[model samples]
Target: MAGSSATGLATLLPGAAEAAQKGVLTGFDLARRQGFPMLRHGPFGLIANPTSVDATGVHIADILHETAGVPLAAMFGPEHGFRGSAQAGKSEARSRDARTGLPVFDIYAKSGDALTAIFRAAGIGCVVFDIQDVGVRFYTYISTLFDSLVACARLGYEMIVLDRPNPITGLDCAGPVMQPGYESFIGRAAIPIRHGMTVGELARLFNAAFVPALAGRPARLRVVGMQGWSRDMWYDRTGLIWVPPSPNMPSLETAIVYPGTCLFEGTTLSVGRGTTMPFAYLGGPEVDGAAWVAALRRRALPGCVFRETYFTPGFSRHAGETIMGLELIVTDRQAFAPIPTALTMLSDALRLAGKPFWSDGGRTFDLLAGDGDTRAMLERGVAPERIVAGWQPALDRFRARRSGYLLYS
Candidate 1:
């Protein structure tokens, strides 16, 4: 309502670039095409979710089970359950997948010795990880990968990663690095918030940087990379079907803003969890929706626009309460910086809403932000630019460390 109030949001978005839907085959697809050669070493367990599928929508566990020689020893599910029926911080109960008839074990928030026990109980010599990640540190799937890597390394299990695209293009990395002592299920290893690496690349990074500390060694790792996918390619460009990795993550647009808006979850505000546009909408009952929109709009943040809106969440945060906020309209994917954008909105909301902008004891925000610096910085009336600038040193160091693990250019 401030910056370009006279113009519609569509006017701020970038023009159509190229409609190149180049056929991109994910690691699972390639592995399936090649007759699941990696699993030939066999009787392997799979750590997967509903997101682990091919272009035709066939689940990985089902494919392996039907394969002639590849033994689908067991199945493991991460957060949101193996079938993806659960919600945030919750997972599906241990039950048999009705379709594949395979027993699904819960590995949601497990790690180290606990995960090792799961590995042992599975009675498999190898473990395969295939889950779609939205290219952020707090996404938990990567943490699942890291914990599984630690367990595999210690247990001497052959680990294979069926690499997937980082729905958000892998070309850019942003946000603050997680500091020491803030480790939790949300932010486990020390990495930047919006880490631009696929599961395969992250596996390499985890194995090289962290597994040694946790397991005294790195697991025997093999990553099956995606064919025809480059660092610059986003999900829309990859020609892969969009599957909601979790209930709230409905589309590629959700993944785009997630690394930034997800920080709102640390605050008392609802990050559109119960609404249809989760991560794309942000508001609280106390938030002055028009003021928040106008403040954000005045900043003229690149690649996005703020439009005033309202919604009643079915659950989470201000459940059953009609709350007002702004719906994010991302216009230019290449130019959009989600973490910085979200921080700007957050600082504005905190300034406008005052005491109402609190969270679940602030520990969740600290963990999500990697440390308490961001929250403290915002509370101290620091500008968003300065707060973002503070992250560059740590972000640069993380980028350097992660470069060695990158699989594609």
Candidate 2:
């Protein structure tokens, strides 16, 4: 996966990102070796979900237990639980690991004091976080990672992030930074909608900001960077397997369209959650499938084609009833940015249909995009290009700012 110089790096990637992953050492794979810099710590605790496995399907937890003589103090689970057995917003009930007898701590909803008790009981020397991030700001994995890091910093525990590929690559940044008042669990730090960096890179961003935010108590953070990982390379290139980070996000296709398709969730439409093809299809009772697709194409939005489709989701909103919507077919990733494309269709929906479309409000868009300005500009009769332009100044500044943390060449 690790290629040569920036020329070769850009050659491998599909876009402007001009670098490749290191060939010798991968972020997670490095831990498998005996005498790596990060492995010397004693009695380490793994804060990983199910996806924390090696290339050959070896679970990281099992690898460390077998290889290093490190005692497993306790396991920490993120939103979907340790094994990722539950769906979104759900986690496993506290249980002992049958094989290792390690106590599992739930950190998704228990970020503050309750979570702190678990860490204290575990008495771990370091926390290893190895989760694949999709490079979107609102995704909860980063939040879970953040809370864990914050806790580690507060108590002076070590944080070792085993880096993984950012499935959305890690170069092109889109949308505006989250404003002050809008900082929720979904949008805590000010970053674009599609932030192009790996979990480790995001940790770097956090550590730098924490140098100030922590008020002199910065996190003892160390990242074991990925080998053969280029910021521009997608999952298919790595020769490593792809694991579903959540129940709804089944495939890379689902992930690619997610940052945009997720916007539908905030609306009355079903973003294909209950069915097998979640985030790939969208529909609601009132949506005009053909009309919406046709009207959306009239603008000739780049890198995307809308296929008029219909479906009945097994669960979630608008379930058990067939509804109509457009299935986005992305022709070009470089030319086709999901955030801008989603906002355009939203604007067109508001323009073509007045109260019915507008009445539901842009709440879904607001939550999905993590900002009101983009959606607001569209509501106030702004064109998609202009709406995108309005946010570019901040977006550009962020792009330049984020360049400081680029891991790959």
Candidate 3:
């Protein structure tokens, strides 16, 4: 576990401090500006995606390939391909990078000995991980990170993480902790659904808390922490350009509602995938848009409004068939509670659709919820408020456990 430690706030290069006064500087931004000092451990393989770029939108793989003295041996892509060409739950096949000509390996769905072999075959002793995360436990990038850490620890290799802002802000956390026996690629830890942590902070937590038990020791890790980032600053306020981390997660608006609405994936509802507004629009063929909106309006949820709408998705659920549902319009992000809001939406949708709403008898829903109790409560027609209230004790424990690993104030 030598060199297994996260750095404090990165040092700003000359003129960078003044530039940072205007907005936050990401770990990649600071590393690039400071001349890629972390790449000193040469012949490093990079685990990255389309979101791994500097402030000027320069891709890290390309920059590393051209940088002098930095031996970047290969590239690794997560759920999305390195260039982000694939869709959800898919990745591009192994190929040579068009720009850098570096060999690209698909690390999506890879872990344990299979993943460690990938690292061994790459002929590298270190891996640099950089990807934008939306701060939800089920988002999958963090899962990729966790698997990578375990593999690195097994192989006795080093892992350097380039941290980014949690687009939703790390002010609070909610939702149920992922129970044991429910570990999937979407969630492999006992963390809350809306895990209010950056990839760097999660790396620290994973290395210290979870990696040891799985790998027999912690990974030799280092996190290049971001400068100018605060716990309360959302990605929009950080002055960084939005790069879609996945094909479906196109905008920050989609990410804001994803933690809760993503639970719909385990249901019969079309979460607006393959449409212009995924996650923001929720509906199905049986849904009554007008009635759903009216019921939601009666609830008077904070920081958001529901509008009756109709959409025909090009792909994924209700394709080419116009479905009735309501669009979620978040008015004040600061006041919007995504999990509770979504729970309310789910309760209302269940009342409208009945048992059919629980796709696969709530198996997938239970996984997405991190526990089966949520689906069970919803099935019993429990109010979203009571369901959310039941989560406070667990949430409080998680928050307290999470505070010690937090890097940013």
Ranking by lDDT: 3, 1, 2
Regions of model 2 farther than 4 Å from truth: 1-25, 34-37, 211-216, 352-364
Highest TM-score model number = 3
- Local distance difference test values of all predictions, in order: 0.84, 0.72, 0.87
Candidate 3 weakest ten by summed lDDT:
1-10
Report the lDDT of model 3 for residue 213.
91
Say which candidate scores most in lDDT: 3
Model 1, 348: alpha-carbon shift in Å? Answer: 0.7
**Backbone clashes in each candidate structure, one number apiece?**
0, 10, 0
Scored by lDDT, model 2 comes in at: 0.72
Q: Residue-wise lDDT of candidate 1 within 93-126, one digit each (tens)?
A: 7788887787788999999788899889888999
Off by more than 4 A, model 3: 1-22
**lDDT value for model 3:** 0.87
